[model samples]
Target: MKKSNEASCHNRVSQQGIKVQLEIIKTEARGWGVRSLNSIPSGSFICAYAGELLEEKEAERRTSNDEYLFDIGNKYSDGSLWGGLSNVMPDAPSSSCGVVEDGGFTIDAVEYGNVGRFVNHSCSPNLYAQNVLYDHEDKRMPHIMLFAAENIPPLQELTYHYNYVIDQVYDSSSNIKKKSCFCGSSECTGRLY
Candidate 1:
């Protein structure tokens, strides 16, 4: 079973997440997107969204407007981003000032990223991003993992909900910021962030 699964996630991609071979393809509208080269069963560990690990200050200097920045912050006991320093208070200022708090750590993949960066957003997605702690016991900072949320068939486009919290996307100039969605799923929310 292990060998077959390893064969599924090709070794050529990277030393990590070698359980499946993935292909980066061009989408007619969404620029670059990733597709599975083989079937991935539900609960399968896909790959880590590998990139340069960044601290908060450096992350701030780089660019908050970047699409490749991912938050891996300390979550509330309920697995939500809230330090709970005070009641209903933000743990730290979200780098994007959207709902995602940096929790002092963020992954900037704009320049150096793996195939995970190409995975697009979908309302009805087959995969999901998860926070996992493998190297250390610190739950505050964990590795961002991509797992098959459902049984994904061969040659299918891989997707995961970006899970951006809508209410917190406000800026002083714009009452609300939104990017149009082109996932084309019936459950499409018409907005990516």
Candidate 2:
């Protein structure tokens, strides 16, 4: 797999399963990454993307440097685009389908988050996000979850697709947003967004 600015990717085991843990590993060339301390089976729960949940307008009021915002407001065609990664991530867990509709909340974890924040982005990923509403019936604020898309070996770095659509996002300078993607998958798009 190719390398990304981040060394690992965030994952989840359950909505309230913060105890489900993995280890953070540092790579001299890749910085810090998340890795399984042991073997993980396919379709297993990893960890939830964790953070501060925000309303649509409130999230919009923040800066455009959306590196850690998870849009719990929209629906996607598949689990691939689940949670609509804005820039960064948070916590959730378990199996649920790809998506449904949400009220208008965004999860921001830049400062407030868990180990799940350590997970990285990949053009090709071993993890998948599923929106689950186990915590409350709000539906607007369902837990954004991650699960193993495939069985992972011990010490393997966890990764998931960021699902960014080229040219749709802009930076604070109003310029087209672009972050070099080093996640070495053959499907790598070269740019993060």
**Which candidate comes out best when scored by TM-score?**
2
Q: Which tens-of-lDDT digit does each residue in 68-128 have in candidate 2?
A: 7877655434444534332223342222444556547888988898777778888888887
CA-lDDT, candidates in order: 0.70, 0.69
lDDT of 2: 0.69
Residues 50-124, candidate 1: write the lDDT tens digits.
788888667766653657877665443444432221222235343322333435687888988888989988888
Taking all chains together, each candidate's TM-score versus the true structure is: 0.73, 0.74
lDDT of 2 at 145: 75
